[model samples]
Target: MEKFKTKIAIVSSLTAVMILAGTASAYAAVPAASKGQATEISAGAKADKKTASPEEQVYNLVTKLQPGEMIAYYIPDKKINLTDRILFSGKGYVLTDYDAYTAKAAQMNAPSLEIPETYPKDYKFKSGVLYLKEPDESSELYKKLDKQLRAEAAKGGKEFYTIPVEDGTGEASGAALTFVKGSVEISLYASHVKPPKPMEGTPVPFSNPDEKTETMVIGGIKCTYTTAPKLKSRLSWTDTSGSVNYSIFADNAKADVLRFAKAIIEPEAK
Candidate 1:
């Protein structure tokens, strides 16, 4: 059983790495579209040769993702571990773990605005900040869960968060949402200020030599970041046999550190 647990951890870790690598490659090739940039509907329509709803367009994009590769369309305010039923296209899909992919997407998609402070100001001790322009709010689905979310926030230590709903475009046609997940609850933080920087002497939780961390320059600003596999025990379980562990961590500046922490600790779905 111990051996089996070890094998599971190893395989899960490798799978996560592969998925992340693939996602990174795909993102690099097709840079995130500018928010409210019409989603290239005409081009997309021509490509698909059919008119599809926005969700369908997103679904098409998701289908392009390789197995183990998931896309995040929202950014959570705080770090959280989410174990709820993810309703995708009226189907209930469980997100066993959370990834920093959505936060990364936000950073990639966000326009280069001037940095307000030298240090990251919007930094959460737990999760990373996801910045979205005001005006992109209006989700029938989210409205359904708002009350439950408020209740969870009232009970939270370090739980889940939702990015303030807003219209991504000035026209108020779309809504922006953030999702943070892991072993704990997820929270949402929204701010007009710049994100805070990593404090000096602050211990970084994950680091890898073979997996070198890199810096991303957005709008002429360089953000320091890294990715590494770290052992997570919170999401583990012990039977009569023994215990099993997981691999998760902070991989980028825009990543939800808290969610990454939870992912590292949470068990992978069998």
Candidate 2:
């Protein structure tokens, strides 16, 4: 168990830890403003210094938002840099590109929101972005983007972008519904830095690290699984382009780990 404690320390060292969906990379990259795009989604939100902050804008989009009310997207607002504000759908999966910096500290108070069990009328997901009918008086920015995106959806192109979220009504032993916004579950890390490699041959007495590179078939997707399991905590990285690292803290992670994995990956299987 001492090794487990060390494992927790090792994986915990990584900063900007978050959830998916997984990894900050998954939440990175806001939607680029289409030059011709003529509307702003945050139109209803006051743009004054305090409210104009990215955190506020992102918060405005979900304040008191109930299930089936607000549609979620993976769009990243490219205008800001200090902290990237991402809109996570119900599954509460947020991703960030490797180079992107998420406003984790700023988003600490994001309101609880959910992914509707069903898409509202005339709404759809395309290429990882969610496209929904423009609510009356909706932000022009979103309207323009949605207009173009909806057109693209008509063409039948899609990605593993959007996923459905259930009301956090059910509780599972290994997995539980998460409504705590801006909280990182598994940050699909794509940063240039990595954890310090343990010296070879000497047993990492602390976490009893078991490192391996293998492929895992979760939710029918065959992706490589790189595990950095330390005794108390585990960090696993997989894939190269958009490499993913999961931060798991549990006495028993098997059931919860796979459950969370399926929740994020299966939605894209459609």
Candidate 3:
């Protein structure tokens, strides 16, 4: 109930954080990457990236959004004509029921973040990203949660992020940006706060695989990280104890993880 206090995430999650890495990349995943060659993939279709595959293009558009912007994004996989805009209540830029499409999905005309394709799902580009899962602004619990998260992000010293999807809430203890050989994952809170549960997908419970955990100091906190010898994907560095002000979740090789950990300490402290 309390751990969800973190307001934001670092812009480094690969399949996740990479979306937040750049504003243009996150919101306009398609043409945002190519810049100039934004010819419609089909007649009257949303823009596509000239340099990337369709999936990479979609991923870029959905992930490039900022913390305050809101839109329901979907691929034109099923229907050719798609809705691209909506009407908002103005408070928190919340989306209302109206959307703009033959589907009648009239959004508030706040610059929409929609993409389309011809028979998109008729082929391999079968997935879409939805943005309709925000916590109700009218709900009392959500209001309290929002207040708590905003306050916690303020503690990071440097400008940090807030939850993009509605799930976790708690005061952010601290934040970290970790890297593996081919991937990088960044966290905004140090403590063992189960992040907000996504509207979709089953939430995986977190646990330290090590019987004896180790600590690497970062972001002004002594973070506890460990590895699951059997589950290579389980390699992680995080702080479950609420003792330190903050820390990082480093899932990298031990040597590099520790080295980077030491380097980030003083700057995060400031």
| TM-score of candidate 1 relative to the true fold | 0.19
Q: How close is candidate 2 to the true structure, as a TM-score?
A: 0.25
TM-score of each predicted structure versus truth = 0.19, 0.25, 0.29
Return whichever of 1 and 2 wins on lDDT: 2
Best by TM-score: 3
Alpha-carbon lDDT of model 3: 0.31
Name the candidate, 2 or 3, with the larger TM-score value: 3
Q: What is the clash count for each candidate, in the order shown?
A: 38, 36, 36
Lowest summed lDDT across 10 adjacent residues in model 2 is found at 125-134
Off by over 4 Å in 2: 1-12, 15-215, 220-230, 233-243
Residue-wise C-alpha lDDT for candidate 2, range 186-235, written one tens digit per residue: 21122222344443355535442465546667556565544554533333
Residue ranges of candidate 1 with Cα displaced over 4 Å? 1-23, 26-28, 31-53, 59-270
User: Which stretches of model 3 miss by more than 4 angstroms?
Assistant: 1-15, 22-26, 29-67, 70-212, 215-222, 229-252, 263-270
Candidates ranked, most accurate by TM-score first: 3, 2, 1
lDDT tens digits, residue span 1-270, model 3: 011111111121112322332233224322222211112332123355344433333233334444334322222222211221111100011121213211221221211222222111221211111122233455564555455444543454322222233232222221223232435432322222335434334556867655456654555565676555542222233333433333333344455445445543444355
